[model samples]
Target chain A: MDVLINLSLNGLATGMLIFLLAAGLTLIFGLMDVLNFAHGGLFAWGAYSGIWIYTATGSFLVGIIGAILTGMLLGILTERWIIKPVYGNHVQQILITLGLMLVLSEMLKVVWGPNQISASTPSYLSGSWEVGGVIIIKYRVFIIAVGLAVFLAVQYVLKKTKIGLVVRAGVMNKEMVQSLGINIQKVFMLVFMIGAGMAALGGMLLGPYSGVIHADMGMEFAILAFIVVVIGGMGSFSGSVMAAILVGLSGSFMAYYVPDLALAANMLLMAVVLIFRPQGLFGAKG
Target chain B: MTRILSNRMNILYLMIAAFLAVLPFVYDSRSLLILLSQVFIFAVLAMSYDILLGYTGIVSFGHAMFFGIGAYTVGVFMKRFEPETSYFLLAVVVTIVLTAVVSYIVGLLTLRLKSHFYAMLTLAFAGLFLVLAEKWRTVTYGNDGFTFRVPEFLRDRTDFYLICLASMVVVFILLKRFTNSPLGKVLQAIRENEQRTESLGYSVLQYKIIASVVSGVLAGIAGILYAVSLRFVNTSVFTMDITLDALLMTIIGGVGTLVGAIIGAGIIEFSHHWLTELAKVHWIFERWIIFFGIIYILVVMFFPMGIVGSLKKLKFSRKKKDSVPVKSETVSQGD
Candidate 1:
């Protein structure tokens, strides 16, 4: 029972991290119609910057904010200089963004050295809480809270705001949104920055949970996030969240019970999703 | 064929072929052998990538999976059997068979996924191969990678170079023929408009799977040759870096052109030397990443059609300008 509870907590914490990454990726794909292969670069940058801050000051909160800011800055640069020219062309977008992913990953090695950096939870949140023979880690609970909070906050913004309506409309039909006198380009940039910020925050939170951060780490996680995005729906925020959790729980459970098939399992889920619903579970029909 | 190749282009190709044929004689023997072999292998990989991305409009990120299957086929066979088995005959038969079966299964499963979804699934598949290879160290020999001895005939570097050269030329000609054939036309049609082709009664998914399988076989060839050239094979050959390297090579040379794949591979591989040379003169250009990044950006931004594509377009414009006087005379006659 305790083992089950522990796995559940671990799964939820990891799922939240994935959700954070996928949330931004889904939004960017949904709103901009751009497949940013370099999205993982933003995640890595967040991890490096946030960890650097945390290491220098011994404050996790500062590290978190610093990482988010780093993502925002990199996001702005990516959109303006790198992403802007390739906006309508998928091939070009992929080529450039893929290059950027390489550059961003290599840059981490340059800045922080190639070795993986260790990150630990603060002492207050390091231990576990037990009740009725079920034990849960406090930091894992904190991660779950942060994930839920980010999800709910985004949902609230999407549901109750004019910007959200424009975003949804844009996702539905960019031409229609343009016909309505809204600057769709600005909206794209905004969504891209926000998505980058979310990915950054996800990276920061993931740092402690995973116990280390490395540059190439983003590509591996980004692959999973991309899988979640596909399974959920490219532009569907809610779908990304649910799909991320599904992937997280499945991966967590499988790693323990079926270690050999664990990696293949997530891929199999994605393959199945692609076969059955190519537009994705929550994606609107093209 | 005469109409396809003008006299000048023919000479250019003959000249390049001659250079490749004699390259081993001039350069440091081992480096030339390895580099030339690498060029051949990568040329094959790049050409296969063109079949999907340039012609079919399906971008795949898991191309290495097929390449790994090819290497693993050779590795598994070499371990279980003898190296003296009919060298070229056996490797070709086994690689094509093994790659075909594996690609068929993967193609059937993944061919239905659209756009980025399909591409990402392929990436996932590659990662799966990587993890399996890493953890199952006993059979795969794990991360250390396995090496098998080449037959005595292949051990002779000059003879081996000839074999690689012959394989490349044959494959190159076949790819060119395939691209201009009716099937190639159908692939182009699918790329331009899949639904329109579907409405015209074409089986889109079947064609995609077939093309994917064929390309997979070609990549498998490259991987097998690569394993032989290095005197060993490892999962590193199937790394994401190799997949991206092939993509970059294809994009840089000419996505749809067979000649362009070879040219692209040559340029990218040779740049290691070029950049190394440049480093002696300037500190600013010391980093290979910066050079690659800048060139990649330039290519995607300004010459997205690629080096060969741009040159083709230039030739087209020049022809138009040359015929202006004739066009004017014809217009006057009509008037």
Candidate 2:
């Protein structure tokens, strides 16, 4: 029972991090029909910038904000310069974003040096709580809280605000949204920025959780995020959370029980999902 | 006009073949021969990719899986058996069969998906194979891939170079015939409009699977040659880098044009070689990938259709201004 609880908690934390990344990717894909392979680059940049800020300022909150701002800046540049050109052509988007992913990771090397950087949990979030013979790590709980908060905030904004309505409508039909007199391009840029910020936030949080961060972490996690997005169904927000948890729990459990199959477990999950329900758990027939 | 174009293409092929025939003796530099062989191997790989991406419009991100399958088969087989011509032949046969089977299954599972989903799923699947190669130490030797001996004939660099060049030329000619075939024309039609082809009662999935199998088999052959070229094989063969290299070559050279694959492969391999050499001169040049990325960006921005593709477009457009072209009529005749 204790082991199960610990695993579930660990899985939940990991899933939440993935959800943060996938949420942005799915929404961006939905709204713009652009597969931003460089989304992982944003995540890596976020982690590096956030961790760097935290170390410099000695304030974790400042670090987080710094990461978000860095992500938005990068996102704005990527959207304006890189992504803007290949809007509807997926092959071009994939190729260009892939190139950008390489550039981002290489730039991280150029900026941060090639060595992996070790990160520490902030003093406020360093301890663990023991309850009923089970120990729950504070950082994991913190990640879960942040993830839920972000999700709720996004949901509320998407549901209650006019801009959110416009964004949602854009996802449904870009032409219809444009016909409704909204500057769909502006919405696209905004959505891309928000999505990139979320990915960076995920990367920043992931740094301390993993206890060490590397430039290439973004690509590996981006693959996981893509898996979550696929499993949850593309363009579905709440579905991302659900699928991420599923992947995270499966990964955690598989790692403990069947180490040999652990790495393949998530891929197997994705393959099974693709074969049985290509539409995804929460996706419409798009 | 079409006859003139064909004659020009044929002369170009003859000239290239003549150049390759004399390259080994004229250069006499072992390094240059090795580099040319590598280019030939990759050109074959890129051509296989073009059959799918350019001809059928299936953008696969897991092509390296098939290539790795071919390479690993040879590596494992040669390591287990004596290095003999028969053993090499056996390895090639096994690699072909395995790549064809695997690609057929993958294509069946994935070809149904729309663009982005298909690409992502293919990547995920390839990642699974990479992990398996890393974990299955008993067979794959883990990340430190094992080296094995080849036949005596293959041990000679000139012999290997000639063989590789011959294989590339043969594959290119065969693929050219394939893309010009009636079925190939249908595949091109499917690329242009899948829904209309489906309405026309062509089984899009079947045609895609056929293309996948052919491409997979060819990639596997390239993998065998690649493995033999180095006399070494490792999990790196399965990396996304390999697939991306093929993709970049296909896109940069010319998507649908068969000759573009070779030119693209040459340009990329030569640039990589030259860049590495330049890295010794300047520390800043060590980061060659940034330059590579910049090239991709510029290509996408400016040469959206690729080098050969854009040139062809320019010529075609000019001809259109001169006279109404019957290219569409000829294409319809092929169908």
Candidate 3:
């Protein structure tokens, strides 16, 4: 029972990180019909920039903010330049974004030097607490809390705010939204920025959770995020969270029980999901 | 047959083949033979990719899986069995059968999804294969791949180079015929518009599976040549980089043009060879992948239609401006 609880907690934390990345990916895909393969680059940049700032400033909050800002700034540039030209063409988008993915990863090697950087948990969130023989890691709890908070906040905005309404409308029918005189292009840029920022936030938090970050980690995790988006339903935010947790928990448990099958676990899940529900779990029927 | 021989493009192809076939005898340079052999192997791989991406409009991210399957099958057979001609032949047969089955299953499973979904699923499946290769240490020897001896006949560098060239030419001609057939026309129609093709009574899924199977088998053949050339096989055969190389080749040459894939492969392979060579001169050249990535972006942005496609477009426009009565049949045939 103890081991199970610990595994679930670990899975949930990892799921949240994946959710941060997938949320942005799903939103960008939903609203703009643009698949940004380089979103992972923003995630990696966030981790690198955030960790650097955290080390320099000796403040975790400042580091987190710095990472988000860096992600948004890079997001804007990517949106304005790389993604803008290949907007309607899926083939061009895949090729260009993949190129960007490579450039971003290689650039990380260029700037930071080709080496993995070790990260430590912040002083305040370094330890664990044991209650009734169930120990909970502080950092894991912190990650889950942040994930839930972000989910709720984003949910509120989508449900209540004017910009959120426009974004949702754009997802359903961009032409219809444009016919209503909304500047869908600005919304696209805005959504791309927010999505990139969230991915970066996920990367920042992932630094301490894993205790190390590498340039190639972005590609690795980006694949996970893509799996989540597929299983969750491309445009469904809530579905992404559910799918993320499912992937995380399956991965966590598989690692413990069937060690040899650990890596293949999530892939198997995705295949099963795809076979039964091609539109994804929460996706609307085509 | 005589009509095909008389065509201008076919004559150009024959001349190139004749030149390449004789060069190995006239010029006794070992390095050039090796480089040209490598180019031939990759050209086959890229053209196989063209059958799917160019002819059928399917963007697969798991092509390396078939390539890896081929390499590993040959590698394992040669290593475990005797390094004899019979075993090598058996390995080739097994690779074709395995690749066909795997591609069929994969196509059936994932082709039902939308474009991006299909791409992501194929990628996920490829990752699964990579993990399997990594973990199945008993057979694969894990990530530290093993090297094995080849058949006695293949030991000669000149013989192997000729073999690679022959295989490439044969595959190219076969594919050209495949693409110009009535079925190939249907595949092209699907590429232009899937729903419209389905409405015209063609089963889109079946045609996609056929293309996938052909592409997979050809890629497997290329993998066999690649492994035989190096006399080694490893998990790197399954990496995403191999698939990306094929994608870049197909796009940079020309999407639907089989010949363009060959040109793309040559350019990319030469650039790769030269860039790494330049590392000896400049420290900056040590990180050649950055330049590769930049080239990819610039090509997509400026040369979206690729080298062959853009040049063709330029020529067509110039002819139009010249007030020449361009034949509509020729324009449609070119497309």
DockQ score of each predicted structure, in the order shown? 0.55, 0.68, 0.74
Candidates 1 and 3 compared: the better one by lDDT is: 3
Give the Cα lDDT of each candidate.
0.82, 0.89, 0.90
Question: Stretches of candidate 2 above 4 Å error?
Answer: B1-6, B320-335
How far off is residue A51 in model 1, in Å? 0.8
TM-score of chain A of 2: 0.98
Tens-digit lDDT track of model 2 for B37-60? 999999999999999988988788
By TM-score, how accurate is candidate 2?
Answer: 0.95
User: How close to the true structure is residue A232 of candidate 1, measured as C-alpha lDDT?
Assistant: 91
**Candidate 2, chain B, TM-score (2 decimals):** 0.93
User: What's the true lDDT of residue B73 in model 1?
Assistant: 67
Screening candidate 3 with a backbone cut-off below 3 angstroms (N, C-alpha, C), the clashing residue pairs are none
CAPRI-style docking class of model 2 based on DockQ: medium
Show where candidate 1 strays beyond 4 Å: A284-286, B1-6, B26-28, B87-91, B273-287, B325-335
Best by DockQ: 3
- Model 2 lDDT tens row, A1-286: 9999999998999999999899999999888888788999999999999999999999999999999999999999999999887766767787788888988998998889889999899999999999998899999999999999999999999999999999889888999889978899999999999999999999999999999999989988889999999889888888888999998899889988998897588887887888999978888756
Residue B205 alpha-carbon offset, candidate 2, angstroms? 1.7
| Candidate 3, CAPRI quality class derived from DockQ | medium
Model 3, residue A246: distance off in Å is 0.7
